[model samples]
Target chain A: MKELTIGIDIGGTNTKYGIVDRDGNVVFQGSISTAEYEEFRDYFNGLAIALRKATESIPFAHKIIGVGVGAANGNYYKGTIERATNLKWKGIIPLADMFKEEFGIPAIITNDANAAAVGEMVYGAAKGMKDFVVITLGTGLGSGFVCNGILLNGKHGIAGEVGHTSVNPAGRFCNCGKRGCLETYVSATGIKRTVYKLLADHLEPSELRGISFDNLTTKMITESAVRGDVVALAAFEYTGRILGMKLAETVVHTDPEAIFLFGGLSLAGDLIFKPTIKHMEANLMPLFRGKVKVLPSGLQNQAAPIIGASSLVWNYLDNNKTQLQEEVY
Target chain B: MKELTIGIDIGGTNTKYGIVDRDGNVVFQGSISTAEYEEFRDYFNGLAIALRKATESIPFAHKIIGVGVGAANGNYYKGTIERATNLKWKGIIPLADMFKEEFGIPAIITNDANAAAVGEMVYGAAKGMKDFVVITLGTGLGSGFVCNGILLNGKHGIAGEVGHTSVNPAGRFCNCGKRGCLETYVSATGIKRTVYKLLADHLEPSELRGISFDNLTTKMITESAVRGDVVALAAFEYTGRILGMKLAETVVHTDPEAIFLFGGLSLAGDLIFKPTIKHMEANLMPLFRGKVKVLPSGLQNQAAPIIGASSLVWNYLDNNKTQLQEEVY
Candidate 1:
């Protein structure tokens, strides 16, 4: 019989689940409205029923052995989701235990960025690498660090929140109740703000000049920059410079071999990477100069999160089990 | 037979060695002037002869099975010391191999701070912690990180160089050819520089007014602060604030549980810790607020480095051997 794992990627509005084999392929995939459910348990119960029907519909002999979840504020150590700002669930939800109860199979849960890191290590550009960082630039920035080949959950399982790390600490207001967070300047929303700021600063005409902030999306900025819109181009340059500077500071922490940029903003390609790499190199400590590659995600954007969730299940079940070194001499 | 490990700490001016048991007790100890020898090979040869004589004088029956050296620029993977500016040695020296040839035993080497971190895990304040960071505040700042209960030897073995991380690209000149390195504001030399700068900026009469930069020391500053000197107090506040700010930034990278302060500048007690902890907590991201502790090394100042070196041997041999997780999902 074929062994299959369920990979669930939970977002603020949508929740996607996939039945995947060990090779990161999604055999069957479906989505549900996450924001509609008043409670997460209700959502999970409905999701379990839908998943079972989908599994039965599959035309192959397979046994679902484990489940993996990638969600906001998902804590690997506690298997709980605690106070995720974007999620409808307000308090700590025992996510992994819910999976176990609903599916009668072992489950592992980690924040989305961590799942992405494991996915990158398992199936993306970071394959075969032991030390690297994965940065997700979507609505807000999120990060996961694989140091010495282990995804860092840290002491509290909130280790890789690079987006919340402050660049100025007093500059920009963040939803996390902090100021000058790197995400405020380098994420998709961050770039849009930059574009608007640039538009106000310079009088040069561009495609973005008359667009309002609510209507002007990151896609418009990318398109405008590609069309050689000076304001849009400067916005990307500024965003990359901030991102690169922060990454240089971050390098001293784990000394990652490579950093992978994923999700929405990274789709801009060289518009983001060139300035980020240049500024990162310029700000880097002398030792890390000419080392540490900043690369785009290996997998295409559309199926990446589901692939990452699937990879997480496979990774937790069969790969990277660390023997706890508890013996103190 | 009683097994003993040789723990050697190499400094610019002196080299300290101890014959230590697995319990971290020094059975025998000796020192040699490191600056006296022009060639590193001749120095090692002479030191070996001296160590042999010292070993023969020991009253107990002990077999030296392994050696551990904590030095500047020591690389755990390569087993070499590469371009240690402070040492008389000018280039890469096969330090571990040198020990092996001289003693006919296995040898391990790592930078001094990493040794301290391992030492802290094995014998000091950070015992039982899976993730922690150790900062050494000596002539220049240095750091070692223990992540997932293993000494982080990153991809290149130079992972924990928190000292070289910059706060501002144009703020301070560092010996590492980078401006605004953390060490320039937190080490023993760093605080001294701060004290002098404070004196230059202030007009108030103080005990530190006429002291030449050459004669000024961190010890004098500490004493002045204790004596209620405003200038010295302000200098410490400034230094601690900078250290704490950088540490807040550093925390996102590794998410350590506790931060252990070792070496000269740490001896200032609350003069540094109070402000450092205060600022660190203040600047910390909301998730890590009041969680990470800034604590002094549990081992006393005089014996800590040697003990850390000895602990490195025991920790490396008897504990914390990581099975490389090379399997990709």
Candidate 2:
């Protein structure tokens, strides 16, 4: 019988859940609205009931091991959601404790980016890589850095927030109150902003000019580029160039084997990839030029986060052997 | 008998060597002129001969385990010095193999910054730290990053090159042919350059104005600052402010336990430290406030690189057995 674990990716808007096996195969999965509720506990309780109902159909032959959760602002050591100020959740909700109590199995919790990194390590492009960075360019840019096959958890559990780094110090204002962060150029909002800037400078026209800010999406821009819109393509090209240059600078410090691109913005193929590669090469230090490859993520976009969180549990089980020296002494 | 290792720190003008025991004690240590007149092999032969003469007088109680060499441009995996481009070494030289043959022990090699980081981990402030970044702000800015208690050696061995990252995109031209690199704002060269800029920008009279570029040393500037030279103090403050802001961005990524400062520029103390710490706190994400620290390296300036390189070999020996995982059948 294959060992299984429940994998959960808890986002600000939705909570995705899956039953995954050791090999990273998700047998069953579903999602629920996170914003439909008033309290995180109510949503969590509903999730527990849904998981129970889903597993009831499966035979006892499949042994369930543990559960792993990936939240936008989860903490691994404390096993709590550190009061995601954006969410309605009260201060320091012990999600792992609640999950363990409900499921009678161990539960591990980590931030979404970290979980995605683990998933990539276990079942994606970084299968054999010891050093790599998983970059998610979505609504806001997020990153997961793996150095020497181990995730870097800094003193305050805030490692790998690459998006916050200012690529253009005087350029754009970031939501974090910082100016000119990398996310300001590479994310969905970042790209849209860039598109508007390019439109102002160039004589090119795009289908996106008339679209409202609320309706302006990365998908619409990508589609417009596909349909031969110069302004849309220019936006992606400009965004990719900035991202690539910033990545070259990052390589000077972290020196990863590869940088795996994930999320919505990464889907723009040659529009983003070509310019990003070109700019990265132009900006890279000689020794690192042509050494680091930027590629798309290997895991299914929807399933990656959940599987990544699950992989964290698997990794913890594998590495946390309590060191023989600790027992011997 | 305790194990002994020969540690060597090779500089452009001098080479420092020491016999270090298992507990990080330097039993016998000394320096020798590199004597640029000789060929690579001849210089190494002389070095080995001098080392042999020193060991002969110490009554060999512990067998030498290996030799660890730290050079400005050493490559750990290749065990070669790739033409020490910054120095007079104009051709590729296999320093490790040459030392191994002469000393009859395994030889390991790494860049000086990496060695200093290892030194800090083994015998300095980062003794028990699993995550930290060590910055050596000398003629150029050099960095060594440790994550999960292991050095971050990226795909091309140039992982910790934080100095090359652009701090101010429009600031100044860099030695690496880039504009506004972090090194352009924070290194010894950076501070001097800043002083020159300050002198040109303001109608200030200071001891530094008469000093030529070649004669304007960090020591002279720092001494002037201590005696209430506004321009000199302002240069340090500006340098520190830029460094602290950059460090804040780094904290968002690596979340290091502490940042250990090493090399010549670090001696500036509160002149640099106060502004650096203030800017870091001010620009830091709220989550990491009052958590991460920036401190002086505990390893003595002279001993850091050699001991750090030796510590790498020690770590390799200690973890070699446990690092390998058995293949699942």
Candidate 3:
């Protein structure tokens, strides 16, 4: 029978899951509304049933070997999600253990960014690369750094919080109660904030001036910028500049070969990529100048989170096999 | 017979060398004036003669198994010192190859900060700890980071340049042509700059006001601060605050278990340590607030460099031995 792993990505509103083979092919895929279940137990029960139904629908012969999950504030060592502000669950949830109990298989969990990093390493842009970084630019900026082929989870399994790294001490206030966090200026929400700031700062004529703060979206900003709106274009430029500078600081820490940009904000193409690359290069040290590449995620955008989550199982199994071989020898 | 490693620390002004055993003991020590030699060849000749003399003076049974060097801008991968502004040498110098040719032994070279980190891991503060950072504060700030017991050299063997990470975009002009680098506000020179800035900003009556820019020293500031000089005390506070904030940012990226402070400036004890620790704790994320320790180096101030350099050989041998055992089994 063909071996397979179940990969699940838990977001605030929805949960995505897929049965994936070693080659990163999804045999069966499904989704469930996470918000519909108010209690943790109810959510787990629904997820378990959904996973079973999805597995039963797969046509090919397969043995489910393991399960992997990706979520906000997921702790790899503890197999729990702790105090995720966006999630409906209020406290620590033993989601990995719940998955194992339901599927009777080995299971692992890590933060979404780390899952993306592992996915990139296993089957996406970072394949065969020992050192690299993956930056997810969705609602906030999240990062996963890999060095010497091992993911840098640090001591607490929460090492890659690049978004919280302060860029400006006196700049914008972040949700974390800090000033000038990289996330406050670089994410999808950050771009919207920047657009409003530009609208207020610049007196130049622009199409986005009439848009209310509550109604304005990153998509609207991107569209306006593409249509030659000066304020919208400037917002992207400012966002990219901040992101690039922050990345330059990151380079001094781990010295990755490449930094891959992923998620919603990254899809804006050259609007974000061009200025980010330019500012990153401009801020790099003399030894690092022109040495590192800034690229986009190679994984299919829609499937990236699930694929990334699934890679954890493959990684865990590979490590265990190596350890077992070492012990036997 | 005791196995010995030749450890060399090449500084801009002087070169320190010692014969060290696996136990991290210095059997014999000596130094040579780096500035006395006009050419690279001349310096190498002097170093070789000094090393031979130092070895002969050791009245014990020993076999010299390997050699390790720590220098400014040293490259572990290339075994060369490249573009070291502080050094008299203009371009790349194959110092490791030269050492090998002179001693007929395996030789390796890495930058000074990395050397200090290895030193701490093998014999000093980070012994038995897998995840930690060593910040060496002298004329400038230098850092070496270890994750999972392996040093983070990155792709170019020049990662962990924490000193160059910008704390302020428009704060101060750095020698690297960058604006507002952490080193510009936290190092020995940085403290002096801060004192000058404070003197200019606040009209506080103090001894430091009389001292000219060229005449001021970190020692003078420390002595003045200890004697209850307001301007001098404020300088340390400002420096510590900046250092702490930068370290807090570093934690988000690497999530180190502890950060060890080393070098001449660290000797000020509570003057720098108190404020630094206070600010570091205040700025840390909720998850990492009390988890990370900021402490002083465990190595003796004088012997740390040589011991750290010697550790490279031991680490290399241990890794190779493990690899060999795996292959044989």
Better of 1 and 2 by lDDT: 1
* Positional deviation of residue A239's Cα in model 3 after best superposition, in angstroms: 0.8
List model 3 lDDT by residue over B275-318, tens digit each: 89888878776667888888999985687899999998888778
- Tens-place lDDT per residue, model 2, B38-137, is 6776678778887897677565575777788878778877888876635565667888778767766778788888888888887788989988989987
Q: List, residue by residue over B184-214, the lDDT tens digit for candidate 1.
A: 8899888888887887888877899878878
Which DockQ values do the candidates obtain, in the order shown? 0.70, 0.69, 0.75
**How does model 2 fare in lDDT?**
0.81
Which segments of candidate 3 are over 4 A away from where they belong? A59-61, A210-215, A322-329, B59-61, B209-215, B322-329
TM-score (0 to 1) for chain A, all models?
Answer: 0.94, 0.92, 0.94
Write candidate 2's Cα lDDT for A229-318 as tens digits.
Answer: 988888888999999988887777788889988888998888888999899988876657788999999985788888998898787767
Scored by lDDT, the top model is 3
Per-residue lDDT of model 1, residues A184-277, tens digit only: 9988889988887887788899889788888988889999999999999999999999999989877867778899999889999999999999
* TM-score (chain A only) of candidate 2: 0.92
Q: Residue A321 lDDT in model 3? A: 78
Ranking by DockQ: 3, 1, 2
Tens digits of per-residue lDDT for model 3 on A1-329?
Answer: 78888899998889999999999998888899988888989999898899989889766566777788989888888899988766888888987777657766767889999999999999998999988999998777889999888988898888899988887778898877778889999998899899888878879999888888889888888899899999989999999999999899999898899999999888889999999999998887667888888899998578789899999988877878775234223
lDDT (C-alpha) at residue A97 in model 3: 74
**Which of the predicted structures, 2 or 3, would earn the higher lDDT when compared with the native?**
3
